[model samples]
Each structure stands twice: as structure tokens, then as C-alpha cells.
Target: MRLRGVLLPAAVLSLTMLAALPLPSCIPQSTPPQPPPPAQPPPPLEVTNPILSGDFADPSVLRVGEDYWAAATSSEWAPHFPLLHSKDLLHWEVVGPIFQTAPTWSEGNYWAPELAQDKGRYFVFYTARQKGGPLCVAVATAAQPSGPYTDHGPLVCQELGSIDGALIRDENDTLYLVWKEDGNSRSLPTPIWAQPLSEDGTRLIGAPTQILMNDSPWEGQLVEGPHLIKRNGWFYMFYAGSACCGRDCNYAVGVARSRKLLGGWEKNPLNPIMKSNESWKCPGHGSVVTDTQGRDYFLYHAYRATDFVYVGRQGLLDEIQWAEDGWPTINGRRGPGGKVLAKPAAFSEDFTSSSLATGWVWPNGRQPTTSVEAGLLSLSPPADRAADPIGAVFARSTNAGNYTAETVLDVSGLPAGMAAGLSAFGDPENALGVYVRSGKVEVWHRERNTHEVLTSLDAPTSADGKLRLRMTAKDGQTYRFAVSPEDTTWTEVGPELSGAYLPPWDRGVRVALTAGGVAGASARFDSLRITPN
Candidate 1:
């Protein structure tokens, strides 16, 4: 083969000279081939839709350092305004509630909590109905996200009711409270308003000024859930419009921008920018939170279409992207949900602590009597609560349409009229359970305060009074109960039952450990676990 670069000095060299060229050691050689660096794996996906699995409506999230904390509406439940924490914004756990007891000044109907942090302190701006009065905006302060909050109740109780209180800071670092007037309750048009907040955020100072209203047709008599963020020399306000909940909810989100916090606000031509998608319905009422990377994500609530509103409005996360025209769009204007997501966090409790975890919840003010120690949990109803149908129940919300809730308990001590078991519960009036009492295992359901035993069977007797119970939910509305004798075997306790009547319009079904009976009766639980399908 002829070498392409060999000139040979334009003359043939003698063989002796070529062979004597220092045995080719003086010549350059091609670099030896090296294997390519091993291909790097792509970074794992770190976020998902329904960031929080169940009934976390009207989410307000805040970032501290690299961690995220969220708060949601409690409706009628107390220890109200459930607080959640996340490292990746994918898996979350309940840290506690905004209050360990409902505020004495507010009676029921807790909704739309907004979380914020300033300097070193954390603040929660929330909405609750005043006792014997209209719904009002309120504020609570805490040293930590999981807090013993101090309530500075009812900062704004307008005659028309005030709800959805959010905070914004002017360029001068002056704080303002932004909220919605609940005028739609009387068929009047609703308006979004802003007012100066005291430096400490305890009270409103200046008179409230109207920011935006239901001037557009799609707005349709209501415009609530106001959230504000400043960017590109403009203050952008995000708000939801129309009816907010229930089966016929027409919930949708819209945007407006202005030079200041109060006036000259103009709506985007593409109003109602975020609506329902195939995977979620009635997406609205969210707060925008910025991550450490300077990226913004909207933490909101939406109904999962597969389960309808039975699981309530679940917390969803969508990246908010800015268009070339300086307008923000959620999930690129395709709406919410339809994301490839890992399953939400699974809950398991072993009853190994002296004090119960903060995740357990009961009725708004009806505290359950419970004690945990030495790997066992004992629950009993208070003497005054005997008339309450649900008695003593400790519950946690489940995230999926189909899932299994199981608990191990000892029921040999239960009295003839007393019962204890695991339940799929909506409220005191709506629940399904498999309970044991006085040598009998029965599947019971409660509808409109009426109790019915779907099936009854001989109790599985054990030397130690140990029994296992399970409730499997299918297609979101059907349920089956099973019993076991502390082994691998589980026998069906009843025919498949319908759970269509469990959930009311505003609350999700929770997996509960319930005990209801005569005075002084109690139930002991060994452990509990929940697996979402």
C-alpha cells in the first residue's frame, strides 16, 4: 500500500538507510485508541402529579432551604389545615396540622390556607367561619412548619364573607393581604381585593382596594383564590373562577397582570388558562412555589377522574412556564395531571411509640381517647362522647382509587354491645367496617346515621385474642372485608358491598381504626398498614 504522506525526498532511499533508521524508534506513531467513557445514566425523575395523594384542596406551599412544606383545607376536620412536607415534591408525609384544636373563634368550615415565611418565622393565612357568623380570613403564626400556632383570628370578616387570603410584598417590602369577597353565595358578582397588612401581618391597615372581578363571561359570578408573584417588572396575579367544588364544579384558573399590587390590572386574552385534562378534572385553587433552581411550580388540587370526587380534590403539581409574551402557563397550557408518577407515600404504623403520631385525625373537636405504649395502641371513647355514633376513631387519608387497609387487633375483651375494627370512613354518618364483638365477626355499614350488619359470622378464636382485618377497595366504590387468624390465610367476611354512599361532596374516604361501644369499653391494636394499588 502506498503511504499518502511519504515524499521520500522525491528520490528512492537505499534499503540499507531505511533499515538502519534507529529501528523505527525515532518516528512518530498514531495515538493508541481509548475506550469511550462509560455512558452516564440520565438523572432520575424527581417530581410527579398529585404531589399529595388525598383531599389536600387549596394547597399553599413554601420552600425553606431545599425543603418544601404544604398546607391544605381541612373542611370540617380539626386539628385543622393539614400540613405536609417533601424533599422531592413527589413523596410527602403529614407533619401535623396548623392547629391541634380548631380555633375557638372559628366554628367549622376551614378552607383555603396560604403558607408563607418571612425572616425566621412561618405564617399561615387561612379562611374559617366565625362562630355564628360569616366566613372570614384569619392568620396564624408558628415558629416552625409543624407548629403550635398562635391564631390572630378573623383579620377580615366582611359582610359578604372573606375567603382565600394570600400575601404579597411591594418593592418597598411593605406587605399586603389579597383576598376574595364571597359574594357568589348571594348571587352577587365576586371581587378580588388587596389591602395593606401591618408590618407584623396581624391586622389590615388601609382600606381594601378592588384588584379584579368577574368581568369576563368565563369568570361567571365568582373569582377567588388569588395568588400573586412579581416578575419582569409586572405583578402577575393567579386566581380561579366559577363554581369551585362538587360534581358539577366548573373550576378553572385565570391570570392578570398589573404595574402595582392593586390597579390597572389586565386579564390575559387566554383566560381560564388551566382547565381539566384527561387524568384530572376541575383543576383550580393553587399556590405557586419556587424551587431552589429558580423554577416555579403550581401546587394545586384536582379531582381524579377515575375515582371522581370520592377521594376529594388531591394535591397536584405542575411546572409553570413563561411564554415569549411574558404570560405564565401551567404544564404548557395542556392543563393538569397526565404525568408519569411514582405512587404516593405508603403509611404504616407499628404502635411502638409512647405518643401517637400527628397524622391521626378525628372529628373537628371530638378528641379521641387513645394511648400507645409497648407496641400496642388502645382506644376508647370519652364518657361524654358515648352519644356520638363514631365514638373513638383515628384515621388517615388514602391516596388511590384502589387500595388495601389492614390492621391487627385483639378483640376478645370486647363486650356484647361493643365493637372495634378497621374502617373505610367518610364521616361519622358514612362508613364501612369489619368488626368483632362477643365471639362474632360482622361486616357493618353506616348510612345516614343508620347502622346495618351486612353479614355476621362466628368469631375466629385465638389463644391470644389476636385477629387480623382487611378492607380492599376496588373501582373506588366497591369494597370487601376479610379476617385472619394471625397467619397467612384470610377468609372473606361478607359479600362485596357498595361504598358509593361513603363520600360526601367535600371530603375523601379515610382508612380508620374505630371503636364504638358502651361506657369504658376499649380496643387494642397491634399494628396497621396501607398499600395503594
Candidate 2:
């Protein structure tokens, strides 16, 4: 579960250094000391099947020269379309969000971001809901791969909704953007449409063409998430089908190929090339990235069967092997089986830094008023606290199936009726947590519009007025809450609670720091420690 470097002992290190040097030429000529064998290179790191640990669904990966970069669907969360970078594809570090905030024209509902590069410019073809319009495909450009990207606004907001904007180049080097018409929403047929992009790859210049549609029995009600890669003179388009979200999802990857960009594309007889196995379920909505050695790999998302859909659809990596027919197979067509995966190290964040970490997000892409100053994180009550959910909330995705999240909140300064606490939040509708008020601690659960206090007790703060809030979940379902004073002992605050009501069908639970109630009601948190069990 833990990874560490093997360090040589000091004596062994000194001897190894001595062996490498010229032996002074006088000490033993009769029996020349043999040079130590060349030090073996470190073994390659073994990354897990779900390469990204959290809710990184509908992942698109781009390999620009030597580095590998990825962007994922952010849904209603802010800092939409988080970009991650990796050197070996085994270890990934978050580069940052492509947009620091949502575009002025879009409100929320971000999904299916595609990462691409052309003409030395890095472009992100992403999906978002326009303010008063339907779901649309938008574009943003950055000079450097790790970006301060400039938003170009929505390109296509079809009557039925347009989503999953993928880019490709034809034999004539003409750029094109392909996306899905979201007819499945109204129980109509969905079509994959392609249109030529302007020189800048921004505007839809040419007339649109319907390249593919939902016609096969296996594809269910829709076909979407089209990505193109050319091999041996054929343009192979990889796409997904069926309900691609929630517990009812039956997603799978299918492929079609054409010699021409907009015509004569034929779906493979073995239409669905990738399907779920015992380990992971409903795998689809991914992109193909060829490595430095020209080996092709598929980066996609799948819900872990062990944790089911509770942890969200995590980003998974599978290799694409070309069969004798030039078609690709993922996981050797065995699915992303139960292979051993590496777990990231547990970390703690104290409010000593000036800026918040990259993962914190708010509901519907709207950030609440918050700040970190003088080694404390202060969350202010929202100006409009009329919403049914907690007034001001900041949260991070939990990657582990079982984990414990603890925060040290300086609750002494909180106003009456205004409480500071920790939460496992699925949306504005669903959450479970414990909060500290003036004279008592209350354990609350929110499902949809209903907010119920599960339990309450007259527990005051510590002598120093600090209270530690702790929330734990096991098997991604059962949850428990506890609170402690300055001491190490934790007192359970509520009955063992089930998290069945917390996770929505699409996203995972976010371990959050919450402040709610009337205006000027707030508290400062000193630190947050997340430990995976």
C-alpha cells in the first residue's frame, strides 16, 4: 500500500564508492579487486489500472513530444476541466485547471473535455451548458501546453445539445471537429456529426456531415465520444454508446473506420471492442495516445465494481494492441481486471500557504467567499445564504474507497447558529456531516431538499476553543462521525450512517469543509488531514 525508495546503508554506500574508484594501483596487484558490477537501474514504476485516483471521468489524453497531458470532465464543479501531466504515465501531477473560472457565457454542466494540439497551439475542446442555451461545445487555446488558456466561447449549441468535441486532421491536413447531437435526451436517435474547422480550428467553416449514428443493436439509444486516429491509411474513429453515466450506465467502446474524412465509414462487425468485466464496469468515453515508442494506449474511465459507482467513474489506462486485422483490442479484450494498483501517499494540508490547493471546488461552478490568511483558512457565510444546502462550502474529491478526513476547526469564534464542520457532500441535495455550534454539536444529513439532524449533544469546545471534526467511510458506503477537543481521544457524535443517499448516479462524494447559517457566521480551520484506510 505504501511506496518508498530503497536506500543503501552508509557503510555499503562508502564501499560501493570505493570500489568504483581506481584502487590506488599499489594495494593489490596480485589479485586485482574486481570492479563492482554496474548498478542495476531502478525498475519501472507500476501504475494502477485506474491511473487517476478520483472522479476523472470522460478523460482525454494528449502526448505532446515527451510529456503526457490529460483533461477530464468537471461536471458542475468549478475550475472546470482539470489538466494533469505525467512523465511515464504511471505517476501524474495536476498541472492545474484549463480555466481558473468558468467562461462568462457558460454557467455549469461541464463534461467531455478533449485535449489536442495543432500548429504549435494547444487547444481544449470542452463541453458546457451556455447560460440560457443547451449543452454546447466550446474551445480554449493556450500557447504552452500547461496553460493560461484563453476561452473562445461556445462553437455549437445545437437544438438537441452538442457534446464531446474531438478534433482531427484529414489527409489534406484540413482540421475538423466532430461531436454528438444529444438526441438521446428526448428519446430520439443520436448522430455523430463532423464539420471542417477554420484555419484556427475555432469556427465551423464547412457544412456539417453526419458521419455516424446509433444504428446497431449493441449501441443502445446513442453513439457518442468520437476520437480519431489514423493507422495504415485508415482513419479509425473510436466512440462510445448507451447511457454513459450513473448506476444504470451500460457504456462500451465501439470503433468505425473510413478512408475519407466524412464518407464511407464502416463499423466493425465486432462493433463494441471494449466491454465491462468483473473488476470494472461500463468502460468508455476515452482517447488514444501513442507513446514515445509508437505504442498506442487508451485512457478511459470505469466504475470500480468493488466500490461500484460510489467513488465516481475513475480514470483508467489500457493498452491498445493491433490485431492481425489492424483493429485494436483493450485489456486483451478481458476488461480492466482486478490487477494490483498503487495507492497515492496520504497527505495533510495546513493553512500556512497563501493559495488553496488545486482540488477544492464549489457547487455549480460558483466559488464561495473564502481566504487563507495568517495560517488559518476562513470560510465566510455567503451573502445570499437562502439556499437549502450549506451556505458556503469548499470540497475535494476522495480517491480512496475507505478513508478518514479530519479537520482542526477553531470553533470558538463562530457566531451563534452559524456552525463550522466537515462533510461528505455529493451535491447541494445530498450530504452527511457533523457541525459545531456554540453549546452543542449536531450530526446532520441532507438528501434532496430535506435536511435532518441525525443527532445532537451538549458538547462544548476545548479549553483553547478548538474542535477537531472527523469523518470516516468504509467500503465507500458506511460512514461515521466523531469530534474531539485538543486531546487525541475522539468521541463518536452520531450513529453509524449509511452513505447510500450521499452519492449521485454520476459523481463521487467530496470530503468537504462546510460553514452554514446566518450572515457573519463563520469559523477558521487550521489543518485538514486525509488518511486512506
Clashes of each: 0, 0
lDDT minimum window of 10 residues, candidate 2: 40-49
Show pairs that collide, candidate 2.
none
Judge candidate 2 against the unseen true structure and give its global Cα lDDT, from 0 to 1: 0.84
Tens-digit lDDT track of model 1 for 1-533: 23587655434556646666765667787788999999774443355677778788899989888898989988877678888888877678788788888888988889999998777887899999999999999999889876778999989999989999998897677899999999999999898888999988899998989989899988887999998889988999999998778778878999999988778899999988898877888889998888776778888888887877777899888778789999998766777844734565667899998877776888776677888867889888778765443588888888787888999987766666777888888888888888886678889899998988889999877767789999999867899999999658899998999989888777888888888777877788989998888
lDDT scores for all predictions?
A: 0.84, 0.84
Model 1 stretches astray by more than 4 angstroms: 1-46, 144-146, 171-173, 387-389
What 10-residue stretch in candidate 1 is worst by lDDT? 7-16
Cα lDDT of model 2 by residue, 232-264, tens digit: 999999999888877788999999999988899
Colliding residue pairs in candidate 1: none
The clash tally of candidate 1 reads 0
The candidate maximizing TM-score is 2
